[model samples]
Every structure is written in structure tokens, then in C-alpha cells.
Target: MSMAAPAFNLRTDLDAMWLLPSLKPRIANQLAGLVNTAPAWMKNERPLVSFSFDDVAKSAAHSGARLLAEHGATGTFYVSGSLVGTHSDYWINADRDDIVELIRSGHEIGCHTHGHLSIANATPERIFAETRTNTRFLRTLEPDLKIDNFAYPFGRASPGLKKRLATRFHSSRSTRAEVNHGRIDLQLLSAFPLMDRKMTPRVIDRILDRAVQTNGWAIFYTNDVALQPSPYGCSPALLAYALTAAEARGIECAPIRDALLKIGAERTF
Candidate 1:
């Protein structure tokens, strides 16, 4: 099924906003990278790759998860409880059944907070409430579900949020584009985009090659996988190409939780 085309180019709008004269957003992101770091040592013996979906659009829950399973792989789906079964402007969010099925099918379900609020400036109390609400909602669907990891909504976070989340989650991913290598920040892992407009065969090859060269963890994130996708999503063909390329390169594809355990990543507190 074709996704509705967005009213405006999402990427272009984002770029324009980020390029504003103040450059505050860029500066804040840089600061986020440097501060509130919960360091972890990655003693990986091989390259690792993790495919994740943020806000988990319906297509991603169905098509994206199916593709990963077909490749003998599983992905992490970061879900916001409030967004579940809701229709957004670009795509529909995954429903409760999708969440249950994901867990049943061996995929990881990470927290994206209850309201999908950006925690960049949220108070600790608010952050706690949001996460707790989300946990409770998810557990309602699957009693044994353990939401271990988290991803920042809109890829925005503050030092205080990171510090607080560190205590609650094993790891938290940001939208920072890079291959995580050597000493890493468990609270703020970097991830590359798997969006339709951003990823290409050559780009995928380069990313995989870098991960192989550094024996690093490469996490690719997107929202949906459909023939026609939102700006933040990718086509199924693109997703397949990525999975196939990773397999060819002998990269071990895993969910974030498994990857962390495999790498023996211990908190440096």
C-alpha cells in the first residue's frame, strides 16, 4: 500500500530549521553528545549491526519486522504507548496486536515514552512519569514484557534526561549518525538513518565497511517500510538491500539489547 505523501518535504523542513541563524539546535546536539555520558567499553570480536524502528509505524511493525525475520534477524521497535493504533499525518502507528506480535516473534520493544515527548528539557518527575506510564501500558499487552532500552523522541535529549534514563535503561539511542566504536556511551548510542531519501546502496556499503573496519556497532533506524514511505521511512527494497549486504559482509545483525550483551558492554558509571 502506498503511504500518503507528506504535505511538505520533511527533510527539507528539518534542514531549514536546523540551519537557522541561531544554530542553537546544532549546538545543543553537540553538547548532548559531550555531556551526561554513561560510558561503556565495547570489547567486540566482530562487527555488529542493529536495525531499529522509532515510533514504529504500522508498515514497520508488519513489513519491516517481516523483512528482518526473513533474513534471520530481529530488530528493536521503540514504541510510544500513546501513539499506538493512532493515525498520524504520514502513516498509521502500530497497534497493540503489533506490539504483542513483535515480542512473540523475537523482536525487542524499547520505550519511547508514553506521550512521545522530547525530554530535552523535561523535568525528572515528568520523565519518570512518562516512562512509567509507557511501561504499564506495554505490560498490559504482554505481562512479561521487559522494556530494557530507550530511544530519544525526535532524537532530542538533555544531560539530565540522559543521566536519569541511564539508571532505568541499559542503553539509550540518539539519532547521531556514526558507527559506535571503542569506548562508547551506553546512555547515548549513535545511529544512522535508514530513511528513503537518505540511504542508498553505496551508502549502506560504506557504513557496513566502516563498522567492519572498526569492529563497531552500527545501528540503523527508520519509521516505516513500504512501497511509498514517509520521509523518515525507507522502501522495502532498500531495507532488503541493507539486510542482504550485511549478510554478505558477515556482520552479526542483532537487536540493541542482544548487541549490548554480546559486546560485554559494562557501565562505567
Candidate 2:
């Protein structure tokens, strides 16, 4: 008898994100050392690790917030204004005040465009509307909300796109978390996707040490932390390990927007 073919074959550890204790502690120590030894100009007023959560998933409310809160750290949640009030399963389930509470606590609320998409395929008008319209919606929800921070929808940035958004946004974040040593490109800042499960703490520390040595701003993005986390999320164990390591050192976590703003006022990309 012949067997039927499988309908689908899923991948295992394809993303290569995981949390390793030894590596994380090393990174934590290295970061603290760099902060203590770095030159005055390079050293930010506050030693900051910017934890940013994308898509504003429901898990973020727990995993992201709890870990940061445990260490008295502040994080940034970049929400898509259009997702609000929509009963879409793909979108998170939370109200305006829920978001407001996150802000009211110690976190910062930032914009992630109206719809998360790539600029490579988006038209100029669409880009402006997505960036500008959502900011308006965020403001309408909370009259005093300040739309200072922003990030590219799909980690893709173009010079032309940067020029368009320069006047409207203060700082823009991206997924290129190597280091920010050279001229800081507001439109093309760097970040590491902490939620990628296969990632090792050693790998994370390697990246962190390099970034801290250069006095570069390192922004880590995530959505959840669980053993069977989503494709773009981390496990709770890993999240705790990383946070513990970070805490051992003097590295305090701050929302991405506040981190930049604390360093200095925003500038054009």
C-alpha cells in the first residue's frame, strides 16, 4: 500500500533564536564594562537597552512588560493605529486605555505606521499617509500623545523614503543591529529581533559588546516569550535569562523613544 504525501512540512529552529544563560551573562558584563569605560561623548546619560515590541501582540502585554518591569526597565510598544477597534484575529486584543496604561506606567507609545509593509513596493503618497495618518489616529485616541518615535514597517529603508519622513518623525528604528558608531542615521537605526527563538545569548552578547564598545544604540524588538513562541517571539525562560544577565550589570532598559530623547533631541536622518 502506498501512503499519501504529507500536506505540509514545518520547519524546526529555522529562525535560530534562543536564550542561553552563559552567553547572556557575558554580554551583560561586557556591556556594563563598556559603559563604565567608554568616553564621555559616547556614553549616554543613562546606560540604556531599548526593548521594543512590534505588532503590539497580546503576549507583549505580559512577557515584554513583566520582564522589563521586573528590572524596573522601560520599553516601547510600536502600535499600528489602523489595527485599533478592528476585530481581526491577527491583530492584538486591547483597548486604548490598555495602551495608555502601558504608557502611564513607564513605557513609551510609538508609531509603527498604519499598516506594516515594505517601502520598496509602497508609493510615495501611500508612505506618507501610512506614516502620517496613523500618528493622527494615535493622537485622537489620547490628546496629549506625542508621536515622536517611528520605525519602518518591514525593516526596509530607502533614501527617498527617509527624506519624506524626516520632517514628521524624530527617530526611525530598523532591524540592522550591528552598531551605530558612524554617523547616526535616524531613518535607518539598528535593532535585533530578540523574539527569534534560535538566537543564543552568546550571539546576543557578541552583538551587544560590539555595539556598546562603539557607544552605538542597540534596540531589541520582540513580541512574546514562551517555549512554543510564535515565529517572531522568544521563550519566557530566555527572556528571564537575558533580563537577569542585564540586571547583574548596570544596564537599565528604556523605551526606544525615551532612550534617544534622553541622549539628545531628535535630528533629521
Top candidate when judged by TM-score against the true structure: 1
Write one digit per residue (lDDT tens) for candidate 1, span 20-85.
745644455577788747877788888999999999799999999999999999999999999999
Clash count per candidate: 0, 12
**Candidate 2 residue 45 C-alpha distance from true site, Å:** 4.7
lDDT of each: 0.89, 0.65
Off by over 4 Å in 1: 1-27, 267-269
- TM-scores for the candidates: 0.88, 0.76
State the lDDT of candidate 2 residue by residue for 1-269, as single tens digits: 99998765344342222134344333432332232111122336544567787767666766678777887787888888766544444335445766777767767887788876555456546777887788787787678887777777766655555556676777677776565544555656668888655677887676566655665566778765556777777877666666665555455566767666655644553
List the candidate 2 regions with Cα displacement exceeding 4 Å. 1-47, 85-93
Tell how far residue 204 is off in model 2, in angstroms: 1.9
The TM-score obtained by model 1 is: 0.88
